[model samples]
Target: MRLNIKSSILFALLVSASAINFSASVPDEGMFPLSELHKAGLKKAGLKISEKDIYNPGQIGLVDALVRVSGCSGSFVSPNGLIITNHHCAFSAVQLASSPLHNYLQNGFVANSYEQEIEARGLTIRITDSYEDVSKDILDAIAKTDDPIERIAIINKKKAQLVKEAESKDPSIKAEVSEMFIGKTYVLFKYKTIEDVRLVYIPRQDIGEFGGETDNWVWPRHTGDFSFLRAYVSPDGKPAKYSKDNVPYQPKKHLKVNPNGVEENDFVFILGYPGKTFRHRPAQYIEYQQKFLLPYTSELNDFQNQRMLEAGKNDKATELALATRIKRNANVMKNYRGKLKGLRNIDLIADKQKEDKALANFIQSNTALKAKYGTLMSDIDKHYQLVFTDAERELWFNNLYTGIRTYQIANLINKLKIETAKKGTLAQKNEYFNKNIALVKKELDAVYESYNVDADQKIAAHMFAQAYNLKDKNVIQTIANKNFKSADAAGSYIAQNIANSKLNTKEKLYNEVLNNAATLLAYDDEILKSQQQFAHEHAPFNQELTRREGVLNKLMGDYVAVKEIYQDKSFIPDANSTLRLTFGNIKGYSPADAVYMKPFTTVKGIIEKGNSGDIDFRYPQAIEQAWLDKNFGAYTLKGTNDVPVDMLYNMDTTGGNSGSPVMNAYGELIGVNFDRAYDATINDFAWNESYSRSIGVDIRYVLWIADKIDNAQFIIKEMGI
Candidate 1:
């Protein structure tokens, strides 16, 4: 007999007999969990080394060498904790260490000794120590809660308890509860976090990002996108924050660099923390992304990029301060554009809709299946309708408050007021109030440290213009009341008001927050009033959206359960920024008919792009001279006289996989995974072996640059080349 929804919804939705079978056919998909490596058929897929070499759970393996550098991935290259990651991953550190007199971001940075290595502020690296399945604990705790919100609350409490229990065993360990399958499976991953990370090497901007945005996600790339950092610990070999007393950390395992890169069709694999993917989402979710999310986000990012460019055009300090933000936004903006194009090119939504229809038919054809999942399709569609109804208005209001600092401060103040007035126990209210108050102060500190009024005003103006042009202008009561004649007028009005506000500075706003909390909600600033109006208008929708998300989470879990039965296979869990391994071979694809792309690119391509006179393609002078002189070092391939710059493979990777080590069959580092082919940006939605090609900077290129251009032979020698 089947169980009722009230008793075992999550349990039934998760652990069917078929789902328990881990040994499914090894498809060219999935960011396989470390625990699942034995079943991943790595050996049959040309892994020359044993599976234990990659992930030996209780003992140290290559997995211990992997590091999550903030949001990107890296690998320890030496016993003393030398790390190799992408240049963009280390760009912020270089920016922090740069100035007009010593511009490391432009001229490059190289530490001659450990004493010279600069501290990388706010940079932390976490190594995965262990993970355990806690699905039964989480699912059983919430098994009886039928109310969606209450069920979610119970889940959170259970996850927190598990994490706290895990972290209790070691002070240096940081524990996280990752949802492997939404609302179904959970895992507790423990990490050893290193806080005293320092910058070791970074090439000049021209050499590091040779093609810039123009070639960011395209194939046949020629960017030497690599950098190095070192992790340090206290004298007693414990994790500690940056200090003069800290010594270099010595890891039990480190990846050995292979000077000779891969040949065509040689096997390669990446080990890193990959971010989110939505392959199993329903048709309506795909529709939402295709119709609303992707385009909207891309356009907003582009607008912000252009505004920042205009604000920093002449000021060198402003330019340097905004460089990281601009580069990050442009990267996302272009990636989203690629994803949107891929969606339309493949008609993903239409295909998903047809599949949904087929699933509904299959369910209806069987009495038992119909009784279990009769309203699944209709229920999912209903929730999506709620999401789509006010998405535009909500998106505009979200950007207004988040993109502009003044509005962000106003919103925080409003939140604090609400928190203060809430009816709760003294301890509860104090904890909540303190948290909100800290948030307000942090925002203030940030604004005081780096807020650019000109840039903020321009961004605010652009956002107001966007809001005014929306079909439902009443979503923002302030703009609606103004009745501006045109988008330009709307933009100019907001900018002028922001410029004239007395509470624009951090000191003034923070004073109000600290001294005048009782009357803070009624602050007289125009921007504050407008922000309150936006909050009032958006509150109902936000609440309903939360409830809808909870409901959909449960429904999607059930849908996947039934869908797996229908498909006769269990799908790989979507990536949730957990450490995973993906393997493929070194090969290329045909982006268009009659045009086959080669797997490898050489320094010749870099010089060719530089000759075009595009600043984005400019190479370093030493690179050009080295090419002209035919000064190929041992880093060059054995058979070919040319030195390799970048290579392509068919690996499954996403956002957080940046800077991951591209390892050859022997588990040696051969390249650094950075970008994906333009056609492969759709891999997040659906993976196609023919078109899903990932790009990485060849290790040979990194050695050549470190040896010939930057003269950092110490780094090469340290790698034991």
Candidate 2:
């Protein structure tokens, strides 16, 4: 049944199902519980998956792959620092370097020599290497303090000291050195970075991302989701900025793309940040997601897609802007649906219930565990209900964001200030202004149109009526058209209406802005002043949070120590956003016995989904022809034509893991993580151990696409295959 209504419907009656029993009608193969898979992952990560090993190699492998890839997460293939990351991670650089004459996204980019590569923007990656048992210091400090503010403060200061001490020893390491999972963990991670990065070679969109958006986040599908770029350093063998002289960063080990594809259950392993899985969430939270939130996100995404498609038809620029938003939202929607489906699986939920019962029984005798976490399930329920109550409000708030004009007043001031401060004469200033006039005009235009001067009055009316429990269509439509207006008339109308509104908040911030337009426009701006004020107020809050963040880290470690059970594959929440490692054999599963999945994908799948000329869809005749010519070697040939182009490996990972490299037990790159199973969103709160599939584009296909399809020899040479 499709849940195609307002989210309010959830308040009347919540759907009930075994948390694990819901399946996508995937035939139930003899399977382990969600808990066991996580346990398996922890063990592979080289941690004991128990309290005793919390300080050991806990999740180093997963952490290694979970790195902030500078611009994006990447895997360190060789000790020499040869890094492999996503093309999108490098997209900003491509954009910066691109021009009317050159479009990197369209034509792709390649650097035959190392010195020519661009250093991407503000990209940095970190990995956790150590953690201390600071539980005693934290408890003692908190025990001595009473006020929440002061207690939080003291905890933070000490944490700073600990991080400093930890990171000071290593020149290359960065320490977030702080807390996680509700203030109970601490960790220090190490990292290696290359300042001089070079673009080795990238194929045209037609070959690089063959299927593009159409094939995105899909399975049982063929899509060559791959790109190649190289890391470089200076002649001094030091990481250097882009210059005339630089060299490719030799890596620890780069995985040779095995054209001979993988078969079902062939040993495979993925080392990447498999974004969240709620394998641990209580039934109430999962149920809420399944019943309401998932549908809401999907509907909202659909609306966004509709708007983008409309924009795409006439305005290319508008289409581009909306395209990014829609693409992101669509992924979210896809995951929501996938998750909902997984959550609805009857067998999956049953398995979860059985495991939960077992866990409860195991903790029944542990007094401390019982006292501290026994109520966790109920707490989870409480939190879920609390969040649910505000579902509509959240939607309203999110929707309001569409009305905001970015730095509407402040952006103009900055530009004027820049023009005012230039060293040149008025003539020079005029020249600069001339050069920038179109951009400035474009900015203003964006604020005016995008802000929905009416603040979505039409959508607002529909929502408002629902909130007030009114059901009159005419009244809603009348209210919408009546409230909204063009930019010129909006200020006066809003100010007057806002002051009269019995409905608006007393703060009346928007009203104040509208009422005093003359003064705001005459001087710098009131909006700008407020922005500054907020920034100042936020500093102390930010510092305090950062400080207490450390204290919470140590405490969290202790918490995990108490919860870590070595018997099964289990996940621990990430702290300090550090890179983690998870290890598991490359294995395929029977979502049931009738359906067995292979661990790799083949080119044949791409042929099946081939499009004649979908702009976003790129399958070049050359690539297809290569396949028709029986171009694949034994390495490329998996036993089945249905080569698992994409494989869902069971590994615990989370958000900061885009483009993370997935390696095998032998430390070979098997795939690059693109996303997590939709059902895994709950993984942020708990590992839905059942839906713990880490989605990655197969390495073999990535190589195949580059070699046979794209016919780029430079990339192959640099990859050192």
For each candidate in turn, the TM-score is 0.92, 0.65
Cα lDDT of model 2 overall?
0.48
Error of 2 at 587 (Å): 4.8
Off by over 4 Å in 1: 1-19, 22-27, 412-442, 447-450, 472-474, 481-486, 502-524
Error of 1 at 653 (Å): 0.6
Candidate 1, pairs of clashing residues: none
- What's the TM for model 1? 0.92
Per-residue lDDT of 601-666 in model 1, one digit per residue for the tens? Answer: 999999888889997998788898998898988878656788999999989999999999999999
Error of 1 at 339 (Å): 0.6
Identify the candidate with maximal lDDT. Answer: 1
Alpha-carbon error at 95 in model 2, in Å?
Answer: 4.6
